[model samples]
Target: MISDDIGKRILCLSFNQTNTCLAVGSTKGFRIIRLEDSKTIIKRDEDSQSNFPGGFSLVIPVFSTPLICLVGSSSNARYPFNTVYFWDDYKTSSEAEIHFRFEVKNALVRRDRIVIILEKITYVYVLNNLQALASIETISNEKGVGAISYDKDIFVLVSLSKEPGHLRMENFYTNEVKSGQVHENPITYVAIDFIGSIGASASAQGTIIRVFDCAKLEVLYELRRGSRPAEISSIAFSPNQNYLVVTSNKSTVHAWKLEKKEKSYTSMISRYLPNYFQYSRSLGKLSLKTEIDLTCPYSNITGPKACFFTENEFFIACLDGNIHKCSIHPVSGEISIAQSLQYFGLSSVSVVERGRTWNNIE
Candidate 1:
C-alpha cells in the first residue's frame, strides 16, 4: 500500500484485467473508477456497516466485474493481514473468505484464478470454489514481486528467490514451468503483457529494463532507462505489446519500443564490441506533470503509476490523486499530455515529517 503516514491515506491501487477500470484503496475504504469517463462506479467507505471498519490495503477487481478481492493493512485494520475477502459489490457483502497462517504480501486475481503471495510461498486457488491448485516455494519476496497475464490463457511470473535475480514462470495452459534469471540484481518489478507472450522485469539497480519472450525464456530487449540507480515503481506493456512504459522514483516515465530480436546493427556491433552495445535506449520520456507527496511512505503512492489506454495513449496516476492523460507521437517519440483530472473525493494531503520508507515495511 502506498500511504501518507501523516494521514494514512491511499493504501493501494490496481487496474482490472481489462484495463477498463481502476480500484483504489485508502484509509477511508476503496473505490472503483471507470477509465473511460473517470467516474466512480462504486465507492465503499469504512464507516459503512456492511464494509469493514478498517480500510483495505489492497483491492484487486476480478476482471472488471463487481467482485473485488480485498486485504487489510496494519493501520486501522479490520480484516486480518492473512485474510482475503471476496466482496460482491452488487450484493454489498462478502461472498467468501480465505485465511492463511502467514500474512499475505500480495494477491493477484484474474479470470478464475487467485494467487496469494506470502513471504516465501505462493498459493494458487480456483476462484470459483477457492480450491487449492498449487503452492510454490520462493525466495525472500518481501516486495511481493509477481505478475499475472490478462489473457484467458494464464501465464504467471514470480521471483524464484532461490537466486538473487532468478524468475520462475508457469504456463497453466501448457503445464510447463520455466525458470531463468531476468536480472543480475534482485528484481524490483515484473509485468506480463495483455496476452502473456511478453514479460518485462527491472532490477533494484533500476537502470535497465529487460523484456522477455516468456515461451522461450529468452531476453528480447535490454532497455536502458537511465544511468543512475532508482527504485522502479511500475512496468506495463501496451495493449498490442509493441511498446512498454516504466515509472520509477526518479519522476520520469520512460517509453521503449520492444522487439523479439536485436536490431541488425546491435547484433553486428555487439560481436565487435562489448555486450552492453546491445542495450536499447528509450524512445521517449515523460516527466510527471503533477507534484508528488515526498513524505508518503509507499513507492506505489509517491511513484507515478501508468497504463496504456491504447498503444499510443496512457494515464499516469500519482499520489496527489491527479490522473494525467497522455499520448506519445509514434514517429517523433514525443510524449504529450492530453488532460489532467483530480479524483474529487480522494484524499490528497501533505505531511510534515517523512515516514519510514515502504521497502522496510513490506
Candidate 2:
C-alpha cells in the first residue's frame, strides 16, 4: 500500500528556458506555475480524453512559450510511453505527438529541433514539421541522462556509456561531434550552460562533478560535491553561466563558483601532485527541512528539483508539495531560505485572487 501511494506522486520537474516558470509532472497531470509569485498560470487536471490520465512523468516547456512536451507514466497511462506529446497550453490540448519503436526515456525541445531519446538511440527532428534529421546511437541510457543548450545555435551532449565515463557532444548546426572521457565511473547526470560555452557532468560515484569547455571538450574544473556518494537529483547552471548549483538525495543543495581559467596553480606541489588534490569545493550549501529521510536507501521520495530563479536566488521544489525560495550571499557563500509555500495540491484560487489583472502575455 505504501509503495502504491508513493508511485502516484510527482515524477519529475523542469524549468523553462527563460526560467520564469516551472513545469511539474505529477501522477495526475502537470502544472505551470509562475516563479515570481508562485501563481498557477496554467493547471490541467487529469482528464479521461485528450490528457495524461495516468500522470506525467516529464514535462518540458519550450522557452517560456505556451508549447510544452510531455511524457506519460503509470500503470494505467492512457498515452503511450513510447510517444512524446506536444501540448499547447494556450489551446489546452495536445497539438501533435511523435512515436518511436522503443520506450522513450527522455525528450527535449528547442526552438528549431526536438529530441526523442530511447534506450540506445536518440532521434532529432525539425520542430515545425517533425522531419527526421538525425539518428545518433548511444550507450545504454536507461535514465535518458542528457542536456541541450537553449540557444539559436545549440550544443547537445549525451552519456556515451554506463561505465568508464565518456560523453559525446554534437552541434546540430555545424554537425561537429566532440567526445571526452569525463570520469572513471558511469556518468549519472549532465548539464550544459546557456550558450553552450561550458558543460558539467556528474558520475555515478557522485563525489565529483567535472566541468568542461564544450568547444574544446577539455576539463576545466573538477568540483567536489562531497567525499561520500549520493544520488544526484539535479544539476543546473545559472543564467549567466558563471555559477552552478547541484542537488542530491542527501537533502542538501550546494552551489559552486565556476572559473573558466585553465590550470594556473603555480605552487611547487602542483607540478608533482596529481590532479585529484586540486578539486574545487562548493561555495555554500543549504539543507532542506523535510520529513522524508533523504539518506535512506529505501526512501520513496522523489527528492527535490532546483533551478536558479535569479543570479543570487533559486527555488527548490519537493515532491512533498512544497516550494522553497532561497538566496545565497555572493561574498560569504551563506545560503538562507527566504520563504516556503505549500503550492502543490493546493487549489489555484487559494494562492492568487482571481480578480487580479494579469497582463496579456504573448
Candidate 3:
C-alpha cells in the first residue's frame, strides 16, 4: 500500500502508535510520510554545516498522537558532541522544527518515555512532561548495549558481555529491578507484541528466536532456523500475537506460531525457506494432505530489512526497495504473496492495523 516514490535509503521506520502517519529515517534526515495522500507532508533536512546534521537512529510516534513524531539521533561521531534531538512537526507542515534537544550517549523511545542508555548509565525520560523518571547503570563487559523493550510499565534491558548477554527487567515508575536472565551469546534484537503479552529476542548468531511471557518472566517458546552463521536482522510479532515474522542475514524469512497450552507457550516453525529458488532437484514425491508455499512474482530478489503481520496479512520491505504484500495464516504458518511494488530506499517498516492503541483498547 506504499504509493510514494521518495526513493532513499531507509535506516529506521515507525508508525505513530495512535494515528495513520508513518515516520521514516534515513542517512539524510527523517521524513513524515502521511498515509492519507501518499505524500511526504513534513520533511526535516539535516544541516550540512551543523555539527550534527540529523543522523537519526530511530523514529517513534507519540503514544496517542499521530501528528507528533519522536526522533532519536546521536551526534556525529567525528564531532565532539554527544546529544539527542527531539523534532516535533505538524502533519500539515512542509517542514519540521526541533522541539527539544538533549545531550545523551544513546536513546530509544517507548510508549510513555524515552530510554537513554549512556556509556555507563541508563535513564528514562517520561514523554508526557519530558522529565527524567528513572535511571540505572548498565553493567556489562561489552562496550555498548544490545537491545531494549518496554512492556506495560516494565522496561527490559539487554546488555552484552564477554561471558554472556544479560536481560534485566525493571519497573519504570518505581525503578525496581526484577530478575535478570542470561543468554549464551550477545543479544542482537528484541520486540514485544502490542499487548505486551508475548515477546521475542534474537542473538548475534541469528539462529534462535526466544519467545517469553512478559508478565510471568518465563520463557514460552523458541524457534531455531538454519545452521550456517547468520545474524537476525529483524523480529516482529503479529498484531494478534499468533505469529512472529523473522528475517535473518541469509535471504530467508521464518514465520513462527505460538501455541499456548496449560501453563506454557510452544513455538512451531511454520515457514522456513527462501521466497525464491531454482528448485533444481526433487528427491521424491510423497502423499500429503496439505501444503503451503510462497513465491514472489519476480525472482532473484533480496530479502527484506523488516517485516510484520497486519490483519492476517504480511508486509515485507525488501532491500531492493520494494514492499511486498502477502496473505498469511498464523495458525497454519502458511504464506502466499498477494502483490508487490517498487519503492526504493526502504530501510525499515512498521504496520498499524485498523484498530489498536498503546492504551490497550481495541
- Which one is best on lDDT? 1
Clashing residue pairs in candidate 2, if any? none
Would you list the rank order by TM-score, best first?
A: 1, 2, 3
Which candidate has the highest TM-score of all? 1
List the global CA lDDT of all models: 0.76, 0.74, 0.48
Residues 173-218, candidate 2: write the lDDT tens digits.
Answer: 7777888788888787888877877888888888998888887779
What is the TM-score of candidate 1? 0.89
Which regions of candidate 2 deviate over 4 angstroms?
A: 1-8, 46-51, 155-163, 260-266, 274-276, 292-301, 346-362
lDDT of 1 by residue, 78-150 (tens): 6877899999999988899999898778888877788898889988899899999999898888778888876
Report backbone clashes per prediction: 0, 0, 2
Clashes of 3: 2
Give the C-alpha miss distance for residue 29 in model 3, angstroms.
1.5
Q: Measure candidate 2: CA RMSD.
A: 7.2
Every model's TM-score: 0.89, 0.86, 0.64
Estimate candidate 3's alpha-carbon lDDT, on a 0 to 1 scale.
0.48
